[model samples]
Target: MSQNAVVDGAANAVDTQKGDYPDFMLKEIHEQPRVLRETFAGRFDAESGRLKLDELPLSTDEIKAIERIYIIACGTSYHAGIVGKDMIEKSARIPVEVQIASEFSYRSPVFPPNTVAIAISQSGETGDTMDAIAIAKKAGTPVITITNVAGSSMTKESIATLQVLADQEVSIAATKSYTGQLAHLAMLSLYLGQERGMLSADEVADAMAELEQIPAQVESILSETSIASIEAAAAGCYKAHDVIFIGRGVGTATCLEAALKLKETSYVHGEGYAANEFRHGPIAMIDAEAATPVVAIAMESETRERMLTIMGEVKAYGANLVALATEGDARAAELADHVIYLPQIREMYLPFTAIVALQVFSRQIALLLGRDIDHPRGLVKAVVD
Candidate 1:
């Protein structure tokens, strides 16, 4: 047997070796709230009006001088970039572009002067992401890396690096690392916004304080009643032939990551789309027989009403709508065929909670379908290419 199999067998034999945890997925899932809390601790200083990112390689002036931002990442990190793009653009008033590492490296895109490339990866050793960073460096763009692993390739290659502090993640499907990435990126956006004079001291301080509480709130959500509701939804999805995930704004990235989890583990046909984009062409694919299983992210934002309207359309078309919304969102609850109540987090942080629900949903679906949650077919923990 392989070394990994030997370790798995040994872990199964000793209850103590597992440390009272069932699996890596469960342990990692439970760690999200705590990881999020630790990420914000000591990082934000209200009095100085500066977000003190310990061990970051870039100076305030360098960050402020950045004229363009390019985020390159793979898998879940890429999803985080999608949310980060929105955060940076809105908060810092900077134009940002996010690209998958594999595509970005090979596509030979033009990089302008004064462009700051942010490379994100959990392992930091993803060959494709590292290659993309190398390409950016060769093209004379400064590189900043956000990574979980401290001494990995991406961290070493970039001019500046911010660690995600998620520690070790054993599950092939990422959980805590995804949230950790969000926390770090959110803080980065806040810092950059302040430096660029796009955000006021009051705004940055308020956001920082609210973010510091996210880990506790996320922990409560996992331990609260929502876990069971998410599991049941996952069980229903296991038998479905296809699943559709929908959201607007930042939630769109959450939808993409959710679909990715389902597709990666359950070997099901899953697609994630912006709720507005659904009307453009995807709606024609929906019907009663083999009806698509829809997971909707209905957060309290400017897009909330529009998201609910899209959910109504999904339900009207006979699609099974499983809506995740904050507590007391009566309209979302009314339209949803199934409802999972999540805690109210910052709009930028909503993706972190929504992703937890997706992780639970995907894992349960994999279990009900008898697929290996840690080792899905035709996939490795790291996509090197």
Candidate 2:
């Protein structure tokens, strides 16, 4: 077989492989920490506390002139862009809009001059995403892409590209690439934030320090005994008709990603809402025995109290709540039906830790339902069309 044929065959074989793990979903889910570590390897310069984006083709002035950013992606990558939008806007003080590539291409949104268009995809072959890039390029917007495959269409076509180094993501449901994309975006946001004077030297250093510890923290989560609790919760909740995921700030990104995972893998009806937004309307859906399991990502930020208030309402409605809070967050733990204690990382960096829990939760639920965890129905490793 030729190289392309070999890759295609390996992707197909993912569905057929069976072992003590039972499914590709479980194996892919468990591979997260290792993949995260590998993604960050040699990408950070600890001595200068700078993210080395030497491969990216933008000068400091070019980066600094970026007044607007539009991120185009699909599915899981789109969810990661939602997180990236929040991070880049808050940290870099640059206005950003995230759009699904399919919708963006069809609608043809207005792109201002000096607008930076970022295309995010693991496969680099997503048709809609590539089409969106073509549209953006035609409109004279500078295009940059973050993708796994080096020579793929998106990489080859964009003005600049950052390779995610996620190496052959065979599983239909993305695990490591999602985290890898988030990590890369986080570092990029930090660099831009520092350049714009939005982040102080100390703040940049602190974030860099936290980023360095993520791989180790992820490794610990993968090896820890606490994963059993996640598995048990998944077994009990997978059959529910509807599930709700809620969080604030970066946690909202986690909530969105979790909903996507459950919906994609278990074929469960899932919705992710900002915790604050639930009060406006979504709360009506919450009821006793409703199985509206709320996953709250509570960090030690100003939004913590707001998230706690939202959880309070869910509790009053007698809705099942699953809280992912920091180690010392006693208030969130008390309100939740089940609380998963996470390491106390910085507010901005907490998403990295919370996502791992959701990955494991989705895998266990797929296993409980006796579904093929890796190759969920109606999905493919790459959307080549």
Candidate 3:
């Protein structure tokens, strides 16, 4: 579809509500906490310790029978899958693989019988993703889709669908839908874990409680203080030629998405690398005089020490260092030139808080650079064939 066609379709969907928002992107970004809430509403029962994800095509028996899982997506959806791969493998004890949709559609990958293929797409019309889903369906593999649009091609073609309904998500760059997709994946992971006997019902109930608190924690990140700090970080990025983000564990997915947000909106040459991966050889490229911005995800986790260690390495290079630290992480504060403090949460949900900080920082960077925050130059909302 053409850009104007997509915009017109989105505009027509919410034309009556357009006046309610300042900028489409900002409105969508701020709506994420609510989107997370709505995405999981009534889908989890803490008291019953049951996940009401019957909407998924597979039953408990089929879920447990599955030998492996493949998640196919593109762009931000692919990042969500990186996080989802961890969620499923840890909770469900399933060997999961995430593939870029365009590549998967062309690669002729093999899967075992009962392998489940999940396609994650916000628009549901991502051409490459849809093509991959078609291939899975043709092979008689059960196909499930998580999509924002109820009537999209992806939803209709799937055996079952997890409808995120993340509002219209009209902005060229995604915001609310990304978080919404994460919420759906979390619920799916918990559900599969309980059904597959990897997690006790009681344990899943406890985790569900934590999932419920994510939105409030995210709301806390949207405070005046948080926005002010992000603006400060953005100031340093105004003339930056390169911005590098690094993290570990699930935080690696956080780093990738965060840097992508900066590049997507600000057109800064941003890249995200695993902290250890950067140490291997990429570290030598860092130079103190470049004033290069190197943002580190030093949030509390098992990998906290390693992330801090990598941050210190970057610090030695005399690059402009910024850390996204947890509320009481004094070590992270001491390690970097600037710190964006997030509320203390478990490592699994750190991406939720960390990604919001990245989005705010990227938005401020675009605004400061006088670039189009919503419809950035030379970018389209979706790469539909």
Most accurate candidate by TM-score: 3
TM-score of 3: 0.94
- Give the TM-scores of the predictions, in the order they appear: 0.92, 0.91, 0.94
Position 140, candidate 3: lDDT: 74
lDDT of 2 by residue, 153-242 (tens): 887677766667566676788887888789879878987887777887778777777887888877666765668767766766777788
lDDT, model 1, position 71: 95
Writing each residue's lDDT as its tens digit, candidate 3 over 75-112 gives: 99999999999999989999999999999966788878
Cα lDDT, model 2, residue 62:
74
Backbone collisions counted per model: 0, 1, 0
TM-score winner, 1 or 2: 1
Which sections of candidate 3 miss by over 4 Å?
1-22
Give me the overall lDDT of model 3.
0.83
Residue 350 lDDT, candidate 1, scale 0-100: 88
Give lDDT tens digits, candidate 1, residues 1-385. Answer: 0101100001112122336766677778887876787778887775686777545545567667788999999888999999999999989988999999889956777887678898899888999898888889889887787877766767667766677767777778888889888887899889888877889888998899888878777776787487888887776667888889989989999999999988887888888999999889998777678667899999788889888888998899988889999988999888977888888877877887888888888888888888877777887777666
Q: On a 0 to 100 scale, what is the lDDT of residue 31 in model 1?
A: 76
Q: What lDDT score goes with residue 208 in model 2?
A: 75
